[model samples]
Target: MPRRNEDALNFLLERRSVSHKTLTAPVPSRAEIEVILTAGARVPDHKMLEPFRFLVLEDAALNRLGDAVADRARALGLDEDKVAKARFSFDNAPLSIAVVASLKQTDMIPEVEQTLAVGACCTSVLNAALASGWGANWITGWAAFDEPFLQDHLGLAAGEYVAGFMHIGTVRSEPSERKRPDLNAITTWVSS
Candidate 1:
């Protein structure tokens, strides 16, 4: 007989991501973050290729990121409100973890696999934060897809891209349950 971890399963079933704007201060400490990162690293990797890395943005770094986004938005002739909202994610959140997808040069493991690994890493980080009782959300807006912004600010390589920007902090409000896709409508099972 095998024992099942019901608590972990229950947590997964009921997990909800809190908004970055609704998060307050009292962010996780270095050691606490390390634990979260450790959990984040446990994502599914098809070819054992560690194709992702984390950039921990804290304190003044967040402000710098916000300013960079604003600058990029202005340069691109984007709406001020949109730019401000994008930047606000960093300004308000206590901590932001940038999950970068660094694609490896390999013919055996396709680029898609590496990209999927990066996506998995992002989810892992978000789940880890939520499970740890910290308010967390995975976010990536126009700024994340802006190549010039990424190159100028985060120094992202040509082959690399932003998987997601996960914000973590203490919760300020209780998040309401959102609608989820129906399993029967989305799932298909085949047995031959």
Candidate 2:
């Protein structure tokens, strides 16, 4: 008989991302983060091409990125409130892991698969952090897609971009469960 871990199943079934703005202090330590990252790397990769990487942001870097986001927003003619909103995620993040989707040029594996692998990596990271007892959320605003911001702030290369920012911190308040999709409405079962 195959052993099933109920706790793991329960964790997955009830997983919910904590909002970055509501996240506070008491984040995972350096050692703990290393463990989380290690766990995050375990994902499906076609052709053994590791198509993802991580960039850890803390303290000053978070603030700097926040400032850059605000600047970018302003330069784009966004109003004050909109600019502030754009930067809010970074400004409030205690610790964030930027999941960089660095794809390789290969005819064997499609670029879309590489991108999907990166997205999986992001989910793995968020799950790892949440399992480690820290509040976590995966976020990416306009700053993630801005070429100038990616190059200047994150130092991403020509083929790389941010998949998500996995923000980790302590929970100030428990988030109430939001309405979930109805299974019957969204699912189709086929049996031959």
Candidate 3:
């Protein structure tokens, strides 16, 4: 008889992301963020090569990043609307965790596996924040994929890339439940 944590399972089944626009001030404290980060780092890592790291962005840092995003958008000849959209998350966010995929060079663990582990880390962070009664949303935009922005502003190394930018804050409104995929439509049965 395996022990079943029903509450944890229930939370997983009903987990939903709050919009960054709706995430308000009174973000988690440093101590709370530390706990969230601890949960984020507890994902599976093959060969024990923890190939991920986090950057906590708050207050002035968020504003600075937003400004950088706007600049990058303009430099790339993006329209004003595009520029605003690009910087919206940063401008509105109370706090954000940049989940960076810092790959380690090792033949033992494939690059793909390392990348997947980083994704898991991002999900863990999002779930942990949500479970802690805060509004949380995982996001990535053009800035996340732009090499120059990543290297220049975020200081990502050669093999490092953004897995996600997890925004955490107070929930302004309860998000309506969106449509969910039908399990039967997506799942495949396997039997031996």
The candidate maximizing TM-score is: 3
lDDT of 3: 0.93
Per-residue lDDT, model 2, residue 4, is 94
Clashing pairs in 1: none
lDDT string, candidate 1, 47-87, tens digits = 78899988999989899998988888888898879888988
lDDT of 3 by residue, 61-118 (tens): 8999999999999999999998999799799999999999898998899999998899
Better of 2 and 3 by lDDT: 3
Local error of candidate 1 at residue 129 (angstroms):
0.5
- Looking at model 2, the pairs that clash are none
Tell me the TM-score of each prediction against the true structure.
0.95, 0.96, 0.97
Task: Report how far off residue 89 is in candidate 2 (Å).
Answer: 1.1
| Cα error of candidate 3 at position 81, Å | 2.0
Candidate 3 has what TM-score? 0.97
Model 3 has a clash total of 0
What is the C-alpha RMSD, rounded to one decimal, of candidate 3? Answer: 0.9
Better of 1 and 3 by TM-score: 3
Which parts of model 3 have CA positions greater than 4 angstroms off? none
Q: What's the number of clashes in each of the models?
A: 0, 0, 0
Poorest lDDT segment (10 consecutive residues) of candidate 3: 154-163
Best lDDT goes to which candidate? Answer: 3
